[model samples]
Target chain A: MASPMSITALASDTIINAGAVDYLILAVYFVFVLGIGVMASRGVSDSVDFFLSGRSLPAWVTGLAFISANLGAVEIMGMSANGAEYGLPSVHYFWIGAIPAMLFLGVVMMPFYYGSKVRSVPEFMKRRFGTGAHLVNAISFAVAQLLIAGINLYLLGSIVHALLGWPLWVALIVAAAIVLSYITLGGLKAAIYNEVLQFFVIVAALTPLTIIGLRKVGGWGGLTDKITSAAVKNGTSAGDQLNSWPGNDISGFSSDLLSVVGIVFGLGFVLSFGYWTTNFVEVQRAMASDSIASGRKTPVIGAFPKMFIPFITIVPGMIAAVSVSEIIEVKAGGSVPGGSSGKGVAYNDALLYLMRDVLPNGLLGLAIAGLLAAFMAGMAANISAFNTVVSYDLVQEYLVKDRDDSFYLLVGRIATVAATVIAIFTASLAGNFSNIMDYLQTLFGFFNAPLFATFILGMFWKRMTATAGWVGLVAGTGSAILVWALTSFGNPWTLPGQGSAFLAASVAFVVDILLSIVVSLMTAPKTSAELNGLVYSETPREDLVDANEASHPWYQRTIPLAGIALVIVVILNILF
Target chain B: MSVNTTQKQHTAGILDIRNVIGALLGIYGVILTLMGLFGDTETDKTDGINANLWAGLIMLAVGIFFVAWVRVKPVVVPEDLDTGGDDPAYMEKH
Candidate 1:
């Protein structure tokens, strides 16, 4: 988000003038956030206890945490913004882009992560492909977390700036310190516990806003009618705004068939799979569960909540598009003269303006607190993941090998502080963007897509060599960057939504697979013994599962749960 | 029993996620309900109903349900149990 950083105003105008009750409610929420950290700290006696919660959390706890960890600024604000701009095609992000890949992670990929027992994703890479690939993965993963965390931190500061009429630097420092205290005090346990609490708070805040917004428009019928007419004014049809399928407007393809292909192949398969399966922010929650079964069920349990998230997130954005005057003005090729950013009205302002328009004093405070919790959850996920990669993968592996458990635990705490401080600097780098989803999608293309290509191919194909791993990742990332460079920056081609991002990811995935095959053919592969638990064909079935697996109920099992979720998602798609 | 003191049961359930969620929602519920009754309801801001009161009552009900759930099924934290190390031999031995 900060790449083309040229704007100076962190925030010029305040969006929410929170009253005393709003402040009290927000205060209570913070106390609980800190309290969770304190309680979680009681459980931490060793490095494992700090880094992985000693893998002590139950499936349900981890499952909720898994989803909560993701209910951050990106999912809430970014999706709402998408909904405001793209309309119903935005649900494609939740349904087509996320659910299948999440299920795939639970049923197919999680066993390897749990069975192999790596603290981080980069550590998993090291066990499979050796030093070359592990080093590349660890560095890139660490860098990516820092950059994303900055985005979350900046948004959090913006929320604070909106609440009180505080300066951006003061708000940034205060918000960073609050997050830093919790992560450093209790490590991953604190972060996960806070995330679970934050999730419920987020739901409680947004559900009313959505229902009230719908009420303001009369009902769902009224909302659809209003937005439908508004779409005509905006020069797009009702189908373009309301329907999710064959979305030519979303995929940046002039033709409907090409748009569907671009959406299904690019966003759904490569980018979604890359983020869910390989990204350690999500994977860490699953890894913290007590057993392999619990770990596997983590994502499966989350899929239930995840599939319905767009209702609260994107629906409110759609509501704002019709109801909020500033949002409407921006939609019809105009800008708010004195918008919050001091630039103009952006799609990101949809939720905030809608809150102002509909919510009264008490509920307004709850909504503001909910937004704060979300931004904190997002930042905590990034910082926690960063510290893990730093202490366990980078520090232990290369810099300070053969350290005592206590020493490494200390290193984790220090890394948490370092990340928060660094994020404060990078937080300023992100200028006001019209829609943040474009930047996020582009980042995922550059990082996660290539990494997913490497992991998926290497895990299935026993013939893939160690050298091919690093070569494929580097080449794939470079290609995605090149593709993005050619398309953006005053280029001839213009993508409607996140088409360039999708194109970059698809190109990266194809390039990585092809290059891995070529490189693996030239290089000698690792022996079957070395690839045992890492590769699917070489490992026995028993090595990848809970040995006492049959005792649990059907709901507790991964296969049955994922199957049920997939069916429900299919029904949702048809109904919508 | 001494080892399980970190997860002390009879005291305030601060560590438990359900309790935290329930208690937080419960407090907000009470506040909003009180506000609905005594303070400004702002019926015009919402449709015609007292939104704070209705939403507050609903939140209170859900919060109490969670508290009752914790009572029905207390989460037992396994203390000082031997953790399964990453060694393949330990897994194979089982």
Candidate 2:
């Protein structure tokens, strides 16, 4: 084990010699990503192609891109930080939270969206609810997208600053500029292609790191002993509190059996269902699939690979905790330093400390690159999505109408630039917050969660009125803000319970849904023809031909394969 | 429009089962790996290795079940009314 200061010094020394090589590798990576964008631009002859990759992407490509987009820099840092702080409990985000949600969205919600043939989630909102609902959805989504972009930039800057002694703004600007250049030139195509490259680079780097880290700490037995010893000294045990099962501590289940049930049924189901079904970022990926069947399977296919992320991302943190515990104990007189009440090491800093001390030089460079890939993938996705929605949903809808293909393409480029600048500025302004990942999630939850609720209701319930969508959108968002403000008062709102603010916003959303239904019943029901148009577009006769073709039996074959995955998950849970 | 509704219904049912099984197998792989990495040796390293054994057995069974199910289940034609394109095969004959 090494002291924090000593570890930092070692990391700095190793990185200094490799600075030129690091920069060269990164430059080449940047140019490669940019080249993909340039090639992708060639396909951008129409608004549809620019926004949706000409809707010809294969199922696997869409699935891969979808997962890659969600795999942002913040997620990597956040997951690593979580692994460091909570041991295995961080797996909840992927397993109990993200995977099931993705599957549900693909199977249930995708059919509706693809069947309707809408370009953007907001456009679908207009059809399902009305103009006012569309406006609200667009505004809220834009805010969330901007915040996500800013957070990614901020994290990228922080990591560079921590590792290389570079100024935060300098790192932020460089990352943003590189990502923005590709996104501006190529739109979703560039983002997808670059994301694919990033996905490979990140996996290649992190997989070996996890293995080496475990070996460094002398295998599983040695790792456990170290952690158990550390935990006993710290007055705790590594159990469900550390592991992310259904009854995990972070799910707010503390000795009350009823609370655990409520968390599983209410929070777990609702949050996962809401995100998978309604999130624009996730939905955008599904929308890019070549066909409805492919769209449905894309998420399911994506989930197979995604299930293993905790191994690569979370395990390293646990290894780090075991390795670093001895140093922290010595430094703080048997107490961990910088954690909540000196119980553990600071979660975000834990992995970095481990990397600095444990990893050799060349391996260290690879790890850094892996982390950078995570950041780039995340940032690039945000910038691309932000530019697309702004250009297609807002600019095309409100500012300009009846535009030519080239005109729309130009608008996309301008939106990309504007979005990049805004994100960079916001990143610079956000001062150092404890656990940068949590700060970003909190900001996103404030804006996006309520919007997600509204979209879910709008899509599923036919009785949901435009008036209800507006009321819910405004009231839900407003309540979240008010709660956030009130919680911040008297103190800086650092308390863990402050996250309950999302609950208030969620309540407002439910109320809005109920009100909308009552209002719609009292008022006139939309005509059947109008409702049909809103829900289902004319199924192109050509699609019927392909649907009838027998060329691709593999698509049909994957159905049962997906079933095997589910049974295996349940059996594992019972057995493990 | 003349496609067998009953067959489509059966296909949907099989698809649902397939999806569940696939998710289970995928999740099982993850859990098995985690347990192997994080299992407490002191409690059940030698005497009560049933937990580890059960995990492995369950994973194998579920995986086998999924493979067997996929092998046995009849393939149904995908309803592809969404792959709209200029591809000649997809073109409607007048």
RMSD of each: 3.8, 10.5
Whole-model alpha-carbon lDDT for candidate 2: 0.60
Q: Every prediction's TM-score for the first chain?
A: 0.96, 0.86
lDDT of 1 by residue, A1-576 (tens): 111212235456687777888888889988988887877777677888788877767777788888888778667877888889888888888888888998999999998899888889999899888999999999988987887788788777776776667888888998898899888887888898888888887888889889988998989999899988887877778888788887777788888888999989888898889988999999999998878887898999998999989999899999999999999999988877644455677887788888887777788888888888888888999999999999999999999999788899999999999999889877876644524533553565478899999999999999998999999999999999888777776468756656787898999999999999999999999999988888999889998888656666776678999999999999988887
Off by over 4 Å in 2: A1-24, A246-248, A256-259, A325-345, A432-443, A480-509, A533-562, B1-94
Best by lDDT: 1
Residue A147 lDDT in candidate 1: 75
Which CAPRI quality tier does the interface of model 1 achieve?
A: acceptable
lDDT of each: 0.82, 0.60
lDDT tens per residue, model 2, A264-366: 4434455455656666777777777667766776787777777777778778777777766544453224544333112333555556666565543333454
Per prediction, the TM-score for chain B is 0.70, 0.42
Model 2: fraction of the reference interface contacts it also forms: 0.00
Question: Which CAPRI level is candidate 2?
Answer: incorrect
Among all windows of ten consecutive residues in candidate 2 chain A, which has the lowest summed lDDT?
A1-10
Count of backbone clashes for each model?
Answer: 0, 25
Please tell me which predicted candidate would have the highest DockQ against the true structure: 1
